[model samples]
Each structure stands twice: as structure tokens, then as C-alpha cells.
Target: MRFGIGFVGFACLAASGAFAKGSIDIGRAVYVERTREGVRELEPATSLKAGDKVVLVVEWRAQSPDRRFTVQSAVPRDLAFQRAGSDAIEVSTDGGRNWGELGTLRIGSRLASAEDVTHLRLRVVGRQRGRMTFSAVVR
Candidate 1:
């Protein structure tokens, strides 16, 4: 379940042109879920072990008026999603075909859990330029 050397390559980070008049840079880092003081942090990930938390960083810089756009990143098959930096994030468990909140999405008769998330879509509602992260675990 570890994120091997392959995970450090471009295949592990997905970037698309969903942003309008803007560009995004995506990268992966090891997620330090908590420390002795309960503070979270992110470290460069060279190799990751099973169950290790990984953070997908999506940073954008835009020069357009009303920087409204959507960005989507595909969750690498080697990882299971845990959470998103924004509370209003949407998830897609079936590739990128369908999207909804975890509580409303279903794989069958059961509700989808965070771990079932396959793709993450974030809507930058306004002219905000910053970084957004999604946490996942090495499967």
C-alpha cells in the first residue's frame, strides 16, 4: 500500500485545464496528520509507507477578473481520500463521471465514504488565489 517511487512522478499528481485564465500547479507531499500538539504539517514525500497520509497540493495563480473556475484532480489509485482543505469540496467515486458530497454519493445501496472518493472537484467561487489541499492515505 506504500506509495513507491512511481508515486513521486507525474502519474501520481493530476493537473487539468479546468481553470479559466489561470494555471495550477499540483504536487504531492506526506501528510503529518497530527503531532504531539495536534498540529498538522506537510513534508516532501520521497517514499511513503502503507497507511501513510499524503497531501495533494493544488496551488493556483490567476490574473483574470472574478477568478471563478473549477479545478479537479484525480485521486491516484494507490491512495484513498480522507479529506479536503475546503469544507465545500465535492467528490466523485466513479472516475470523474459523477460528483456529489460523500454523504449523498453511493457505490451501490451504501453511502460513499471518504475512502471511496476517486476524484476531487473544487469550485473557486470568487477571485481567490491560494493553495488548496486534499488528504489521502496510501492504500
Candidate 2:
């Protein structure tokens, strides 16, 4: 697993007049099946191939108590977004220019597919091959 801290800072400076600190942590695990443990909680592997599910675990925390946070991460160009685990996430296909829920997002007239996703952003990051980056802000 590779992890990188993209950015961390405060938001809503004009409203609160105080800075809030936040951070993002990222980790990766390749999917594996264990007969006793069942499906989703499989063991972690270092490498993965196509058609294999990879899991990315991200942790976001805010040092301030009363602030809302917006955390985002850059998905590597190679991985596809798995819609099942990402219900609360907002995604972007246009290089972060726009964002929407998975169901409402569209590329041209066609609804966005996992293949069309360029960014999977939420409070968490997905695990994939190569180095990954993540950022967070507290407002």
C-alpha cells in the first residue's frame, strides 16, 4: 500500500474567522476470499489483476469539532470505481470540474459507468496499483 498526503487545511475562513485542521490517510488491499470469513472481509494482497476487486481504505479526521469537512482523493487512472461501496460518494469525470452522485452523473447523454469515472471522491480513497494521493479540508 502506498500513501500520500495531498493537502490539509481550513475552509470557511470568512465565516468562522478561525482555521480548522484536518487530515487524510489512505491504504490499499487486493481482494481475496477466505472460506471461513466469507466474501468482503478477505485478506490483503499486494498486487492485483483485471476483474479482481481491490479495496481502498481511507481515513479522514478533523481536529475541529464544529466544522464540516470535504475530503477528496485522486484515483489512479488505471482503476475502475466499484459503485457498490460508494453510495455516499460524489464522483467526477471532467478532471474535478463537476461532481455528482453516482446515479445522477452523466457523460454526454449516457449515465456514467464505472469505466467513465475519472475521480472517486468522498471521505475515503480506493486502493489501486501505483502511488495514490489524498486531500482534506475542514470548514
Candidate 3:
């Protein structure tokens, strides 16, 4: 009876971990051009130390029609940041599992400019030791 219970407990823990990894689809497509006009992935090649902060900027041109877009970011395990506006641009510290409002920048319309730049700032927590990935979606 003891062995059976232990086996089930271990199985449950393993399953939970597998489920968490499966929840993330890092396989999502990435753009391969210099136009800066598609879903882009941003992250540091090396793991970040705690209390470290990095500025991530996304530059793109939204074609006319003035539509709303959603940007999703997956914060790596053990990092946190305060998001500042809208869904068009967002920030996350938990590996993209959850996101908070960061800020917003207009995309399409006469008001759009080729030189417009959108910025998101993220602070890395020392307690966390892993790579964080960010994704931006423009529709």
C-alpha cells in the first residue's frame, strides 16, 4: 500500500510538470526579415541574474485600417516586472504564463510614423535563474 501511494504521488508531480511545459508553445513562428513587421522573439542568450533589468524595444509599421493587435510575452520562471497600458503592447515576468498592461503605441493611420518606437522595460529578479522569452503580435 505504501509503495502504491508513493508511486501515485510521484506520478502526479511528474504530470504536473509535463503539463506546465506543454502549456508553452515556444514553437510559435518567428519573422525572418528586416522590416520589423511581424511576430518577433526577444531574449538574452544567457540566463539573467536577479535584479537585472533590460529594455526591450519593438519597432514596426502598422499598415492602414487602424486595427488593434495583441502582444504576448512569456516571462521566464523567477522574474517579475511592472507593466505600464494596452493589449497592443504587454509585459510578463512569469514566462508568459500571465501578463500585465505595459503601454500602448498607435499602429496604422495617418498618425503612424516610420520612426516610431515602442519600448518595454523588464526587471530580472535574482531569485530567478533562467532565460525569458518575449513575443509580440501585431494584427
Candidate 4:
């Protein structure tokens, strides 16, 4: 009985450690305004470790006539871009001073739509230790 209990405890600890090591926490920090046409606001702020692959997911309503949006990344100087999309997004390694196109999200024929989600992925590279900001503009 003692052996069985110890084995189960060891297994539980190992499982938790594995989960913690592989976990990436993504959070949203923004005030979203809703309209009859759609919703609008900046993308949520995210905190990620250096050299971590961060996938940003933005969810909003597309009820407005504006079918266009812009996503921007304000990255620290030390990080390098692995990949990004253009038309819908731009990435800046210099903290929003200059930006290059990254990615795009297509709404297709859907306009004045609501309750839609858009996703973007960025690989986070560690340069210096600090916080960075990212945003999305829908006009």
C-alpha cells in the first residue's frame, strides 16, 4: 500500500511539472466598445517569456461597415521576427517607431457581421528584460 501511494504521488508531481514547463499564458487587457455595426478597440496586452512562441487571439464583433483592421506589435529590441502576416498586421522591433507588414485576417464576404474571432501568432524572442505592447486598430 505504501509503495502504491508513493508511486502515485511521484506521477502526479511529474505531470504537474511537465504542464508548467510547457504552459504559455496569454491574456487580454482592453476595453471593448460595441456598436450596431461591430466592436472596436485596441488588442489586449500580452506578457511572454523571451524565446517563447506566442499566439495572440483576438475576438470581436464584425457588425460594422469597416471591413479593415490593423494589428501592430511593439516588440523589444532584442527579439527577432520569425514570421508574421501582411495587410492585417505589422511588426516593429523598435517599439512602434517603425513598422513592417506582418499578417492579415480575411473577413471574406461577411460585412456588418458580429461575434467573430481573429487569430495571429508571433514567436517571442528574448532580447532585454522588459514589457512590450501590441495593438489592433479597427476603423
Clashes of each: 0, 1, 9, 9
- lDDT (Cα, 0-100) at 60 in candidate 1: 62
Ranking by TM-score, best first? 1, 2, 4, 3
TM-score of each: 0.77, 0.57, 0.26, 0.27
Best model number under TM-score: 1
**Which tens-of-lDDT digit does each residue in 49-133 have in candidate 3?**
3343332222222232232233233322232333332333443332334444432233443332212223232332221122222
TM-score of model number 4: 0.27
Candidate 1: lDDT over CA atoms?
0.69
Any runs in candidate 3 off by more than 4 Å, and if so which? 1-47, 85-139
What are the per-residue Cα lDDT tens digits for candidate 4 across 27-125? 323222234457544332233333333322322222232322232233222223343333334443333444444322224443311112222223233
Give each prediction's root-mean-square deviation over alpha carbons. 3.2, 10.4, 18.2, 19.4
lDDT of each: 0.69, 0.44, 0.28, 0.28
Report the error of model 3 at residue 71, Å: 2.1
- Global Cα lDDT for candidate 3: 0.28
lDDT of 3 at 35: 24
Model 4: per-residue Cα lDDT at residue 107: 42
TM-score of 3: 0.26
Q: Summarize candidate 2's per-residue lDDT along 1-139 as a digit string, tens digits.
A: 3322221111101111121331222233234323455645555534444444444444433333444444455455545555525456667877678888766778899897666655655532242222222221111
Better of 2 and 3 by TM-score: 2
